[model samples]
Each structure stands twice: as structure tokens, then as C-alpha cells.
Target chain A: MARVIAREGQERRVDGIGQGDHLCLVYADDAEQRRVVTAYVRAGLSRGERVLYFADARAPREVLGWLRAEGVDPSTALTTGQLSVTTAAVGYLAFGAFDAHAVAQTLQAEVSDALSAGFTGLRVSGEMSWALRDVPGADQLGTYETAVNAVFAGQPASAICQYDARRFSAAALDDTQRRHPGTVELAPLHLNSRLRVTPSFRCGQRMLRVQGTVDHHTIAAFAATLETVLGWPGDVWVDLGELEFIDLAGLRALAQTAARLPAGRRMHLVELAPLLCQVVNLAEFDDISSLTVTARDAA
Target chain B: MTDPAGPRLPSSRRLTHQALIYGSDEEFLAATVPFCLDGVDQGDSLLVITTAGNTDLLREALRDAVNKVEFLASEEWYGTPGSALGACHRVVDQQVAVGEHRRMRVIGEPLWHGRDAVETAEWTRYESAINLAFAACPAWMICPYDTRLVPEAVIADARRTHPELAVGASTRSSPDYVDPAATTGFWERRIAPLPADGDGDAAVLDFDADLAAVRVFVARTAAALGVSPDGVGRLVFSVNEIATNALQHGGAGRLTMRLAGRRLVCDVANPSRRATDWFLGYRPPGPGQERGYGLWAVRQLCRLVEIDTSDGVTTVRLHVDLD
Candidate 1:
């Protein structure tokens, strides 16, 4: 069975990527993105799969040139119809704005074409940096990304959606990661050990008590707790009295999760540090109706 | 057409102005249209200056009512703070020259997306200068900024500069608002110098012609300090942006990284006197526009950043909390 390349040289079984496997690849910049693509494409070619690269931020020629520089003979692959590179307009933005249905149909066609040409399967990768623009249908991107997962269901094609952390907003990156099952986490893995998240049920409300440091590294732990609270029946409260530090990403995670609550359900931030509350106010997170923030000093 | 009994401004001068901080287009349109229509119906001349995207949005929302409004591009009207203040004075003076109305209504959004460091600082100064520039004028100006696009620091400054805040259906006096006179010396104190040696020895690396090598050097140093993998990634990216700016503007520079009081501090020093502004990445970029996102990206990734220039040397210090 063929496998998909995960990182610089790591490969996972085909089951890990096929049958409608959609991967959210988050990169920092052009250099980082190029490194990931080189690995992905080389792995696909070695697996006898037809590869398709959609150029959004860069031109097709530049992508081809980069691929060539990475030791992948894109020209020979193109001549043999084993590799194809096109613009985002052709693949993703078929109708001037990205239509999920159109993109899925195009992917279906590419997959069929690849199989008919004697290739075992298809691998498609697209740069999502274009979505950051004021395109007509850009607001529907979250829906489109979610729909793509279902659109490619049961297909042999393995698709990867690439987002540059530098280009896209932190909110967009967070939303994108949640929409896909498999994610390349941009948050640093080795977190500060002082971080502590204790989830408890108090008076029929889901409460999460966070302590020590809460930055990008440990935001996932808080987010997981929030996910559970968001699904609950009543109100949720996050106690931050013991939190010595919390970065912007951590605060955003709380705000985003609070904003996701169902109507009439609220997320109350109880006992927030004075300085942390000020940062939230500065960022206007306090303006969110679903979230009622009360500073510890005020109380 | 001015009603004797209508929503009155707090100022004794009958001037009503505020900053419209909105997250999306819908919020922007909802808050702006009602305000503009209220002015237009009152028979006041409305001046709307912003980016092309916002101009189109306002026009579409106002539809036939746009004819009564004078819309100017932000770059043309007030590209720089000094120039913008002069233009503002000219607009107020010209309106005062008309004598057709006692009060002129205006909406100025001079700072939006894609501003360099100097432009952001000057524009922020201009925002503060507005209170003085039109201190006694009967002109009421409301500035609209997209929260999704603008930086939080700029938005915070907007609150401090503008005396009022406008939301969906109501406008209220801003509690965070400080007198513009009190904030006059803001630019001078924007960045303060850090101490030479705080706790630990700093790792300094001079970079030129090799960003990748610099990334490796920072990575090794940051890893030794036990920085998180994600923090390391952002540090590398921040250093890259700072280094790129240094190389482009000042030929070559040195980057110093050290842990200070639970914060990883990295300073990029160069031989340029041009100081970067506080609003480097305040606004998010629209698609198809790729440049000018470098420093802004750095601001987004790091916890806090301070840029200073003194004696022909410019330094940008990026902090990432390790605790």
C-alpha cells in the first residue's frame, strides 16, 4: 500500500491519507512551504501517483522551478503526464470565486483522469493564501473547506490544504485546523511545564481552572476543555486566578470558543487577572456578547 | 434641518465624533450607514475618506444617497500624518469658508491596510493631532477602522485618541479616552531602551546573505534555552522578518537572543535611524496584495515587540513569554 509523506522524511500508510483524507498543512513562509511541498510531491511520485499542484501565491513557473531545484524533474513528469501544475483560478477559483462544488468536481475529474492514464491514485495540494484576499466568496471558505472533506469522501485522492501562518490571521488558521481532521499544528509542541488545566463540574456549569503559563503551546489543552463546555447545556466559566501568564493566542482560543456557544448559552470568564483582563479589553474580546469577563481585582 | 430635540453630542460645540471599530464588512456598514444618513438628513456635508474597498462598501450601502457624500481615497487625502493634518485643516477651513452650514460632518479612515512603520506612527500621531487640528471647528468626524484588518495596538490608540465610540445603534463616551493634549508626546515615548545585561548572557549573531543559516543559529540558541517548539518557530520567523528589514534598509545587522524574566527577548540591531512604527501589522492584508506584511507578521507571531532608533542605530526587540 502507498503511503503519504508527513514531514521532512516521515511517511505514513496510505490508509492514513487515502479514502478522503484531507490534511491541513500550516507553514510559516515561502521557504517553509516549499520544503513541505518538495517532500510531499517527491513522496507521491515515488508512489506512482499523479500529482497536482495549484499555485495561488506563486506562479506556476516559479512552482515548477522550485520543484526542479528540489531535485524533482517536474518537466519530465509533465511530459509524461504524471505531474501537472496549474493556477488557483483553474482548480480552486473556477468561477472567479471559490465554489466548493466546482472545486470538488474538478478534483473528481483529475482523479478519474489520473486513473485512466495508468496512475494508481492522485495527490492534489493547493495553497490557501489566496483566501486572505477580498474575493467575493471568501467568507464562505470555512464552509467550503468543510465541504471539501465530504466531497472527497471515498475517493483515492489525497488532498492537502496549505495555509501560511504569516499570511493568514491567527483566527483563520485556528478555524482551518478545526475544519480538518488531520492538522499540521503550528503551535510549538514542547510546552512550558508550569501550564496546568484542571476541568471540573461546579453547580451544573463546566468550569476550567487554568494556572501558570498559557501560551500557544498549551492552548490546545484549554481548547479541548472549551469544546466540551461548548457542547454542554448551560453556562461555562473559565477561572484564571492562578494564571501567571497568558499570551494572545491563549486569549484568542478562549474568545473563539466562547463565540461558538449556542444561543442563550454564555461563557463567563471568572476571576481574570487585572493585567490579562486589560489585554482582553485592548483586543476587544470583552465586546463579545457571549463572553462576560470579570476581572479579579474588580471583584 | 437640524432638529432642536435630537440626539445631541456631549461637546458644547455640537460636534459628535467617534471611532467605529468593526470586525467585518457587515458591522462596518451597519454602524456607518445610520451615522451617515443621520448627517445627510440633517443637511450636513459629509466627507468620507478611506481605502477603495471600504469606499465601495459605503457606496453600495448608501446607494443613491452617495451623491450627497464626498468620498476621498485615504492615500490621497492624508497619506502621511503631517500632510493629513494639513488636508484636514484645509477641509475644515474650506467648509468654514462656505458658511452654508454651521457644522460639517466627516468620516476619515486614513489608516487602514498596508502601512509602513513610519506611516503608521505618523498616522497615529495624526489621529491624536486631529483633536487639536479641529479643536474649535464645528466639523464632526468619525473614523471607521476594520478590526479584522487593523492591529489591536492601533485600535487601542484609536480609543485613546477618539473621545467617543460608535457601535451598532448607539454612540457612547469612551471610558478609555484620554485628552489628545495628554497624548501629544506619544511618539517620543513609543519605545524605551532595554537594559544591557538583565540576568543571562545574550547570544549574538551577525547575519548577511544567509537567512537560513540565521534561522539555524537562532534555533540552536533558542532550543538550548528550552523554548517551546512553536515558540522556536515564531522566534525564527520573527528574526527572519527583522533580519530582512535590517538587510534591506541597513545592509547587514546583528541579532541578539536571550531569556529575560521568563520572556525570550531577541533584538535585531542595524545601522538605520528610521524607527519602525507601532502599527506595523495592524491591518490584515487583502488578497492579491503580498508585500508589506513582513513586520506586521512579526507583530502577530511574537508576544510583544518594541522598535527603537537612536544615534544611527535601529533595534527591534521581540518578546515571547516562556513561562
Candidate 2:
């Protein structure tokens, strides 16, 4: 079980990294990420671990400059084969697309290679900003992150997965953070709760647009927003296109909300993933005598 | 007319088909009670399947022998001829196993009132088909018709179905009784033939793999027929099961949907060698069973479910009441 290694104060430093430790660093800007990465890499180098950084949002030379600013000699580390900085295109996208198992296997093999080459351990940090380009299988990024927990367990390796919050949806950020055992928040701007629920009236109909996750942490906000929407005029259309994940509790909340609607108004759930559709269908939500809940794909 | 409580006379017959035509409740009792009592005296299994009104009458007449007889609810147990026959066979098999070769008596009174033309036709065919259903078994069945309530045509159909007629306690051969196979053939020939185009009010969907389209089509058709919102969903859920079963076991199939009076009916026909068994969907699925709920859900949701097999094609009819 890896614990949080970053302190909650000014000059936050990432430390205490050991074998089988997996950490995530979420940032809002490249300028703020430098301090966190520099501290993280220096901690590994001081422990004689081979450092591998897959940079995508910034060039390798620019990242080296950041390391130099942290009082580390980049030229010496580069020449001594102790550190390697490569672009995301060459490192993460070696297969031209990301597959959850393939990525995890590749990283595991790399860790084994580093251990065989006489390094005490392997330290890896990859910038996930490349996922914003809509690459095939990018939607599996969260699944890959979750898989890494088993990959690094009891292995002589530690990983810091960096994601630029500005380049990803709050849902993606929330999902990524939820999968990692530890996270170092470099910018407080993106630290807000990852749930945005808004209710409004459109053409005499009550409507709600839901984004991010609807889990235990954000169910209350969802319930409150739903109540506000139900108070408005005729019928309801809930656009769930932006909703990334929903738990059973969240689904129950929706069912209860629909049950309490005014007479003659129907609730339409539009644009749900296939798995979500199966969950909704299996529940027989529309069979509730008091409510008219219809699930359909957006026309 | 012979005395209702007259002394019993021993008889030897392979399969006894007796139809009792009665004018009043007393007459119905006189004819049916003797048949049931004779079975009890012979130490044979007796099963009485009839309406609640007649069940009470027979229970009182059976007196102390009521415990020895088994009564099944006719409304729930009798749906289509095929299903009713299936239920009768199950009861007969159980009773026969207990009685050995003593004999088995079944008094099946499938109500002939308030049924639509389609149901009436089906029951009429059932009456004829039962001869074939029990030809090889040593079962004595007495079908009672209320002369004051049942239509004249129904009585005539009964005459054609049974080999003998019973009034009071007397039995006589029926001139109208045709061979069981001939009776079965006559009724099958009278069933409404499938349309040549198969595309009038009925929309034909040849479904081999896709189940979603079946659901969508059922929903749209049910909604158009003014089925309640909950009814539409339930109908879709149930029809989805039927379509799935047809695809998996019934082989290549086509679903035909149309409005029959105030009811929405969908017929799923497949080129399978066997018909969907009657008891397939009428019972709860057992533990660890994965593939039995499809037809059972259909039975739960639809108002009427019937299966018929003819000339290598199996058709399952799903009827949802619009009112």
C-alpha cells in the first residue's frame, strides 16, 4: 500500500518513493509541473534508480532545462545513462495506439530490463497529455492506470503518471485520480471537485446536463441538482453524453427523482453507453407505475 | 334418460371419450359425478379440471372422496389446446405412476363462454386434438357441455370430437365422431392461412441475429395500439425474450406483428423440427439455470401465449391486451 509522499505546504516535495509505489501528479500548467517532476526524479536518482520520463506536452530539451534549474546536472545524468527523456509519441505510442494490456506489459518488461541492467530500481513518469488527441483506445486510459497497480505491486519500480488537467475533461481527471493510490496536486486550480451538474428550462421543458462522475462523492450534488430541475415545467430530458461513470447509488437517485415527478411529465435519458444501457434496462426502470422513464439513444 | 345414481356397470374400453350435454346444474352434476365416482371405485386416479362453479358442485357430489380427487384451476391451466394437453399429460403421468394400470379419469371442462372467435376456434381444435393426445394411454375423459349456456355450434363441435355421448348415466355411440386423425386434420385445415404477401397490416421482420430490432418493433407497434406506457415496456421486455428463444433454438425465423381487434399480437415463426414445449415458460426457473427465462418472461408479460407446430414450422403467438 503506497501512501501520499507529498506534503500539504509551500515548496511541496515528492519523497518517500519505494519499490511498488505508484503515484500520480495532476497539474494545470507546464510551469508548475517542473518543480514536482524535478523533485520526483531527483529522489529516484539519489537512490541509484534509473529514471525514465516520457514527455509529450513539452519537448525533452525544455524538461532537461527544468531539471537543470533544480540544481541537477542534466548533461552528466544523460551521458551516464542514469536518466532518459523521450517524447510520448516514441514511448507510449510505440504501437501507434494504446492497449491497456499491451501498455502494462511493455512497462513491466521495461522494469525487468532495468533491474537486469544492475539498477537498484526503475523510476518512470509519463505525461498523459497525448490522450487529448483522440487517439484510438485512449478512452482506456483509466483502465490502464488501474491495471498498473498490479503491475508495480512488490516490484522494484515506482511510477508517477502526470496529467495536465487543462488538456483533459474533469471526468477523465477524476477517473485517473480515483485509480491511483496516491496523487500529488501541483496546481490548486484543478483541485476542485470533479462534478458539474446544471439544471435549466428549455422551451417549456426542464433539462439537465450532467458531466464528470456520479459516484458516492458527488451523489448529493446530483440529487440536489435533480430536485431543482424537477421543480421546473413540463417533461425532462437528461443529457448524459458527458457523464463518464455512474454508480448504482446514483442510478437509484435518478429513479427516485423520476418517481416523484409531477403527473403527465416524462423523463428521457438520452445517449448512454451500451453497458449503462444494459444496467438501465435490467433494472426495468420504465416499469415503475408512477413514473414514465424512457431510455433511448439521441436521434 | 338413465338414473344419475344408478348402479355401476363394468366396462372395458381402451380410450373412452364421453360428452355430457346438460340443461341445468343438476343435470351437469348427475352426468359428471357418476363418471368421477366410478373412477374412485375402481381405485383409479381422478382429476377434475373445470370452472370454479362446477368444481364446487362436483366437490359436494364427491363428498368423502373429495380428498382422493385432484382439482386444477381451469382458467390458469387452460390457455391453448397444446398447453392444456401438456398440463393434462403431466397430471396423467403422475396419477398413472401411482395407480399402476388401474385407470385414469379426467373431467376437463374448458369454459366455452366469453372467449373470442380466435380462442373459441383454438379450443374447438383442442377438443379434437385431445383424442390424438391420449390415444395410446388408458385414460377416460368426460367433457360436459351446458346446453343452456354453451352455444349450439360448440355442442356440435363436441359431438364431432367425442366417440360417445352421455346423458344422465346412459352412453351411446356418436354418428358424428370422426377418426382422431381426421378430426385433427379438419381443424388444421380451417385455420386462417398465412397471407401470400405476408405484409398487409402485419409487418414481417426476418430476425436471425438482431434482438434490438425486435424490441423496437414491438414497442412501436404496442405504443401505436394505445397500450399503457408500462404495458409497452413490459411488452417489449417480454417479446424480446420470445424473439431471443426463437433465434437460439427455433432456428431461422421471422416475427409478424399486427393488431388483432383490441389486442396486439406478434407471431414468431421458425423452421425448427419441434414446437416450444407448453411448460417451458409456465414455471419458475430453477437455481443455476441460465437459459430458461426468455419464454417464462413472455408468459408473465403477455395476456396470452400460444405455440403451434405444423409442417416443420413452429409459431409462437404473443398477445398483449390494448385495453
Candidate 3:
């Protein structure tokens, strides 16, 4: 590992995404900086990199437009080109409304395609920041790590790496180890991701503690995580206290699932950021006393 | 109104799916009454299931003909995938028994999805044997005055799945359809307020015809709203589209004059889809793309064009502000 000078006493939290000697992304200002990032992405693609990107924001236009121009229609073909780009705003409006599994299946399908394509480097932009907040799965850094290693398994040394500014709990490290062993962990990538989900376990209740932007990608993960945790034998409490944004999809998912959870299963969401809670109320998810997006800062 | 190439419609001897490509569903039913009476003369049983309560139109259109009605129930949200598959299986089983030599043809362009998918898909999804079975006899369709919304995918998939299936389109058209692109804006500008505050599956609104002319239906609608519409070239592309939804969807298709707040609104109450998409507004032949922007054009034009489709009735209110 190359040692670099630290910025005083500041400890930067980052999500990791690596494939071989290259990394997923690092903060870049313009085309020049992006070139450095693109070089690695291109190299990964050369090695058959399966890249999945959800443009959750607008800034990532240049990168996404390039991919979309390259003929990446993820909805139809089970397999897109080695790379694919999708936008949440467009997705919602395209079908004229929200369809959750349709959106989620898009990624699951992309990842599966990437594995088949044997794609190496996957570069994503847009709401990568918000993806880190509530649903820090594929759209965020967490998924990047899993995908990189899965796609580049048993490849040459230095053929894989992970870099993201979004950090989950150090405890998830244990879960990562227990679930996905042998995948080397890389240092966190430091960038300006809007929202960050710092996961942690409290009193045996698995809490997906969030801190940052709350968008469509993260929202789906929250519901998915809850569904995942329900299969386990513990009372789960999801604390979105530090979250910043919550769109319609996020609010609806939490409300719908919370409404019909079994008696054995109790979900209590605590600490919602102002904007986030309002969406929950608007979508009517908070009406369920079982689920709470209260006002408090935890992260 | 079908050619004599395939089996005649409303044939009682054949207990099978009969699909008729008619001018409209109403026209199909109108022809079906005469056709079924002929079938009755041949000594066979007939069962009619309608999703809409307007079967009275079928009765009235028949000109007082004697026809037996087993039951009339709504076939809208009727079955599931499993049930659909079950129904298809039975339909297929019966088709197989008819003869290994004769072809079985599945007919009718029915609008189907979800709970309605079973029966709809049966008429839609193509199985080789079913196609062969239906190839011998097909459904006789009637719709000289009805507007139907069917998913494009169903047709294509059926064609691809069953290349042997024969389907055709009717040349007749309806007149109630208001082209969303060119006419909506012109309505809001000159038309007045709506009256029927009564609520239900549909909302009935009225507008003045004297203030607005049908010749300016496209330009005036947009001009009245003081807004420029894109693809105004697609306005009222056909008279069939303009009329079908009016009678079939809303119940009637004619210009009405009503007063709302000193404003004379010339409203046309017709059945329109919850969506503004119509076959006529299409750009040549592209689908599910920038072509479906016609409704968006309508939404932008009308001052208060409300679409209320709750029960089964769908009434679209196009308000043209008249001071």
C-alpha cells in the first residue's frame, strides 16, 4: 500500500470499490481528473468489466451520456453493453409512475449481465452520494465491493480494488467477513457523496443507521434490508435519524412493508432528518406507530 | 361486416374464442346480434359477457331482435395468471379434440392485463395448437363506435408467438376523440366553467360550440390557451379516433354548451383512457416513445381538463374559458 500524507487529524470515511490494480472512483474536478478515473474504468472494461451505474444526480451527465450514447438500454436486453446507465427521475416518469421491483430488478440484472460479460471496471456517477445513505448497496460503495470481487474472481494480483467515501459500520466488516470471506478489503474512497449510511448493530438489533442523502436507490435498500433482517431471529430497528432526503419511492416502500409486518416482526425506525420525515408523513409511512422517523441526529 | 373467408361470427356450434375486427365494439355487437340470431336458427347456445353496462346499446342496436341472454356479468377484473393458464389449457384441450387436421383460430383484439390477463391472455397468448385450432374458425369483432386501449406488446408477442393467427383492423372510425395535441389549449382559452359537480366513475362537463368551431379544433384549442403545441400536425389525424371514445368510453360524443362563472365552456363528455395516449396521435408507426406525447399536449392546453375514471365511467372535462 502506498502511504500518503493525512489531512491533519481528520479521519476520512470512504466506501471501497476495486478491480485489480484499479479503483472505482475518486473525486475529480474536470475532464482531466476524470481522465485518470476513466483510464482505470477503460482498463477494467478491456478486461470485460461489467459496469452498473444509476445516475441519481445531474452532475454525472458527461459520464452517463457517454454510456447511454454507447447504446445501453438496460430495460429491454437482459444483457446491456459491457456498461449500463439508468436515471431514477427518468425511471419514475418513464413508466408514468413508481414500480419498485422493476427498478431493483434492473440492477440485479445488470450485475448478472456484468458477471456474464466478465466486465472488470464499473464506473458509476449521479446520486452515488445518496446511495450511501439509507440503501448503501450496489448503487453505493457496498455493492461496488461485492461486484468487483465477484466479477474478477481468481484473477491476477492487483486486478481488483474498491474506493468510495461512504462508510458502513466497522461491525459490518465482521458481517462482510462471515458472508464474503477471502475478498480483500481496500481503503475507503473519499468523495462528496450526498448521503452516507454508516451501518451499526445495537443490542443485537441490526440497525441500518443512515447519514446523508435519501433517494430512490437508498430507499429500496432500506426495504430490502428490512426484508433481509426479518428472516433473521431478532427484533430490528432501522434508525434513519441522520438522513437528509427521502423521495416518494423511499417513503412508500417503508410504509407499505411496515403496515403488514408479522407480530413476531416489529420494525421501529428512529431519528429521521427533517426533509426525510416530511416525506414519510406525506407518503403516510409514519402513521404506523410501529415505524418512527423521529427527529434526532445519531451519526 | 367481415369477409367470407373464415367461419361466421356468433356461431353457436363452436364453443371457442371469436375475435372480430370490427369498426367498433358496438358495431361488432350490432352485427353479432344478427349473426347470433342466425346461429340460434342453426340450434346452438350463446353466452354473452360484457364488462360494461351498455349492453342496452347492443339490445337497442339489434332492432328488437329476439336473443337469449344466459348472464351478463362484468368480465373486467375476473381471473389470475393461474386461472388464465387453466382457462387456456381447457381452451387448448377443446381445440385439440376438434380435429388434428382442422386448424383452430383464436380471434378478437381484447384489452387485457393483470386480473383480466387470464381470459385476455387466452385470447392473446398464442399456443401453436390453439393457433391451429383457431385457424379453422376465428372471433368476429364489432367496434364501429368504441375506443379500446390494448397493450401493443400483447399484439406483437402474439404475432411472434403465433405467426399463423390472422388479425385485421377495421376501416370505420368514431368521432368523440379530442386530439390532445392541437385542441386542448384552444378549449381552455374560450370555453367556460363546468356544471356537473356530481361525482362517480366519470365527470360530465359541457362547453359551447358557437364560440369554438371544429375546423379550428386543433389551432384554436392551442391558440386559445396562448400556448404553442408540439406535433400539432398530429391533430384529429382521423375521424374514427375523434368519435370512438366519445360513444364507447363516455357514453355519447357531441358538442355541449354549459356556463361556469360567466364562462361558456363547450364540453364533450366521452370515454377517454386514464392516459391520454391514442392510436391516431402516433407519429407514423412508433410506439411507447416520444410519440405518445399527445396527451401531454392536451393536458397543457385545456384550462381545466379533468379526467375522472373511478367506477367504469370515464368523463373527460375540457374547459374553455368564455368571459
Candidate 4:
């Protein structure tokens, strides 16, 4: 917020607050909340601003339908689905809400997306239409701004910058280093919370493109994406140079991925994970090796 | 009782043929598939037994050195000679039937273990073993180093020991001992050639697994396929793995192979299972790695890997290109 204000020389309100690029709001409600929030967003739509909406899967369709009728294409808005609390938050960074409504049944939960859903302090600091309810830590002074900045800056792939211990678990991170070669690391601050996430579209040389641990949890997504990317009906580099852990599940996923590719597409593994290399040999996967991954030089 | 394992029922087909020997041991391995190799052939139901289960030595001689034995279990015969003979007899009887294409081959280096092994009275037992094997043996050949030590009287008393095989030990050559009286099948050669060359079936091969023997077996097959022996030794050892598995599991299974197109396609099917991933031919790390290493070895050496398992049928095929 400060960078945006400083760089743009935006005016600060006399109420001891800085003007910000984005605005958000939170409120505690009992009922009749929908009418109020929809009105707020309708105001923005009437102003002819392209509004983006973000909400849980079962959010009220009427509010979104109203926005769509006003002209925002539904596809442009992203869905975080039911990702973890932190992931949902990072998604929010990209998927900032217009007049979105996310209502959880229980406010406090064992594993709820509440930690990353705070919008409590933006009302006085900036001017924007915000109508959220019982945001976990909404009353904090500048906490909301800082959380928003995290996603705006430190762009970890797929991970929404909130907090997580796995980000810098000495053992897991160290293990990653042992197998992978790299120096500069923006490690997680703790077990569950990341330092911050500020995503950039820039594909930088300093980017440590990591090969993720391929397990049942991620195999389908991994393979389908690989296949889709390869089947782009045009040229695309499905770079897998930095993948680390690949178990049997991962191997099968890769095999399935290669099998699904259009024949003679020239797929290459380009420095495949150790176990994947073995799968290639045993299953005669090389029969379509040109269309999948190929081992690349170890740098 | 008599050793029931010898060529019993003479082949109604009445096929007569000469021994076909290739120049190299590997050539013999490739050209010598069960049911037919060069001038020899075994029927579909072929049982193989080998007392010498030295996998290392067999690898050196067998064509599918590792891939052949990759997925099956293999072990040396630890039971008594009599029981081993009994086992052989049972295998023969179980497979060989009247008008059935049953053939069994038993190969081992002959050793005078004790009086129990080569006693003159044991001739009946030896004859029974051969009779049982040959009863179903479409065409059988045994490569025992010396049966000469066993007295002629012992062999004579046996049910079907080649009575006229000059009844003596190593006086001349270690002549191959065969009895056509056991499951003889006539091939009308020029008149009635083979069944169009590609009647493929699952097969199992169990042989005395000596590394040298393994090498000998592999070299025979390689030479038959006419592939230049440049770095093919690895392929040879790879195929041996399947053979080792057959030996350890099937007790006796034939190495059934056919020359399909440019490929010397062979399979060593066994009634055993080794569920390990060995796509890279290296020393398998498990207990069965010796033969379990076959899958990995096969993947490395062959052009294709086709494994079909259904009901009780398991076949592992490795195609070695002749060109």
C-alpha cells in the first residue's frame, strides 16, 4: 500500500491514513447481509468499473448473477475452491473480491480458511466498497495491509502466502537443498505461515523452479496439467528440470501422462527424477519418449 | 518301484532327426527352443529339470540371461537324488498323456555323489526318470557329464535306458543320451514343415544355473538369431534371469522361443511371482534380486517387453533383433 501510494503520489486522507491501490471491508452480521453487500457492489458496477468476485463454492448465485448481468464475464474471476487457509489467502491476493460473500458455518474451526480471510482494517485507511463478516482478525490496525502485501510480493508457486511451518522445516528444507542445487532461498517463517507472497509474472533466472513431491495427492493434477500443456496444439516447454521427490504414484502419473499425449508429439523429460527414469525403462515408456520428459544435464 | 521317468510311449508321429549343433554355445541357446530348435523340437507341454541351479554360471551361457528369469523364483535342488528323480517322474506323468504333445528335458552335469547316486541297482531308478521324462518328452536330450560310472547292468535293468548306447563310461565321447521310444513325434521335414513358424505359447525353462552354463545357453540363442555379438553378452545374461526364475519356481519349465520376423522372441514362463521394479539392469536389492534382476535386465537389453498374465498363465517376452 505504501509503495503504491509513494510511487503514484496518491493523496492521503486527513484522517491519518494513506490512500491504497486496493480496498476491502469486514462486518459482523446476523441476517439481511446479502442485500447490503450486493447493493455496495451494484454501486461499483453502475459506475462502470470491471469488478472481480471471489467466494466459496456455495456462495449465493444471485449476487454473482447480478454482477454478470452488469457485464463482468464469469470466467475471468478465479475460484480458490477449498484450498488450505493459506492457499485460499494467496488466491485472494490474485482473486480479490468485488462484492463476494464467503460464509463458513462455524467461525472457529480445526481447519478453516479463516486465518487468511481477514479484511478488518481497510475501512478507515482506504476508500473501497467492502462488506465482509466476522473476518478472523478484521479489527487489527495494519495487519490486513501487511497480509495483502505478502501475496503481492513473495510469489511462491501454488502456495498462498499466509503462514506454514513446512515453508522452513529445517529438515524438509535441508533435504530439498541436499537433493537440489541452489543458494538464495525465501524460506517459510514457520511451520504453517509463509513470510509473504507477492506473485510476479516475470520468469526470472533467479527463480528456483522446484520439482515437487509427486504423490497421490498431486499426481492427477500434475499429469493432467502436463498433458494439457503438451497438447497445446502449439509449441510449449513443459520444463520439469527441478522436480525432486517422485514416488511410485508419481511415476504412474507420468506414465499415464505420456500415454495420453498425441502420438509423435516429441515429449521429453529433460532431467527426469531418478525413479521416473526407471519407469521409462521398464514399461517401454521410451516407446513414446520423444513426447515426454528426457533427462537433462545436472547443473 | 522303478524310476517312472523315461521315454515310455513311442511317438505315434515317428519323427526321426539328427542332433543339430550350432558353432557357439549362444547359438545353441537361441536355436534350441523347446519343442524345436534347429533339427530338434519338443511338444507344447514341455517340463525342464536341472539339478545344477547355479544362476551366475547359467547367465553366462543363456541367451535371455537376465530377462528370462527376471520375474520368477529359482533355487538349486536341495532334496535327495531319489526324491529329485521322483519329482522328475511326477512332472513327466502329469504332463505326458496318450496322443498328447508332452515333452520334458532334464539337463545337469553328472556327478558321482555316492553309492546311492550311481549304484548299479539304481539303474532302474535312472531309467524310470528318463522314461517318465520321455513318456511326454516330444524330443528329449540330457547333457549329463558321465553316466558311464553307473554300471551297464544298472542301466540295462532300468525300464528304457538306451540299451544299445554301447554300454560303457566315457570310453569314447560323452555321447548325448536320447531315447526316441519316449514320445517320438515325426516331422515330415520337406513333406510337412513346421506349423507356419509363429504358433506362440507361454513357456518355462529351468536349467542347472551355472554362470558358464548360462553363458553357454545365451550364446547359443544369440548366434542362432545371427546378431553380431557386439555387447550382446549383457542381453544374454539378461535373458538368463527369466530362466533362473523358471528353475526356482516351475521346478521345470521349457525355454520356448520362436524366430518371429527379425526378432528371436523367447519367453520363460514360471508359476512364481517377483513384484519388484527393475527397469534398469542392475543388481536387484531384494532377496530374489538374482533372478528378480531379470525384469530390469530385460528392459535394458530387449527391444520390447510384453508381459501377459491371465489365470495361471504368465509369459514374459523379449525380442532380440537379428539385424
Candidate with more favorable, higher lDDT: 1 or 2: 1
TM-score of 1: 0.31
* lDDT agreement of model 1 with the native: 0.69
Tens-place lDDT per residue, model 4, B77-131, is 3132333343443444444545454443333322334433213223233333343
Q: Write the per-residue lDDT of candidate 1 for residues A1-299, one digit (tens) a residue.
A: 01111112112222345546777776554665676677777777878899988889888888888778977787778999888888877777879887766777677788889889999889988888777877878788898888777656677778878886657765676577667766532222223575766543322234566767654345567667567666656666777877765655577678878888988888888777555575565444665779888777543
Query: What DockQ, on C-alphas, does every prediction get?
Result: 0.01, 0.02, 0.03, 0.01
Put down candidate 2 lDDT per residue, A1-299, tens digits, no spaces: 11111112111226655678787776655666887788888888888888999999789988888878878887777887879999888777889897888989988998888878888889999898888887988888888999999888788998888876556665676577668776663332111256666442222223465667665456677777677647655556675766755644466567677778888776766655444564444344444444443343434
TM-score of each: 0.31, 0.43, 0.21, 0.24
Q: Would you give me the overall lDDT of model 3?
A: 0.38
RMSD of 1: 22.4
Cα lDDT, model 4, residue B114 = 44
lDDT of 4 at B172: 23
Candidate 3 structure quality by residue, lDDT tens digits, B1-323: 23212454454233233233334555556455665464455443344444454455556655534454332443531232222223333444444555432322222223353423323433332221232233334232221112344455553443333322212322222222222233343111221124443112222223222112332453444344333332221222111123334543454454443344422333444544553321121111122232222222332233333333333334444443342
Over B194-239, each residue of candidate 1 has an lDDT whose tens digit, in order, gives 4543467888898785666677898899888888876776777667
Scored on chain A only, each candidate's TM-score is 0.56, 0.58, 0.32, 0.29
Q: List, in the given order, the native-contact fraction of each candidate.
A: 0.00, 0.00, 0.00, 0.00
In CAPRI terms, where does candidate 1 land? incorrect
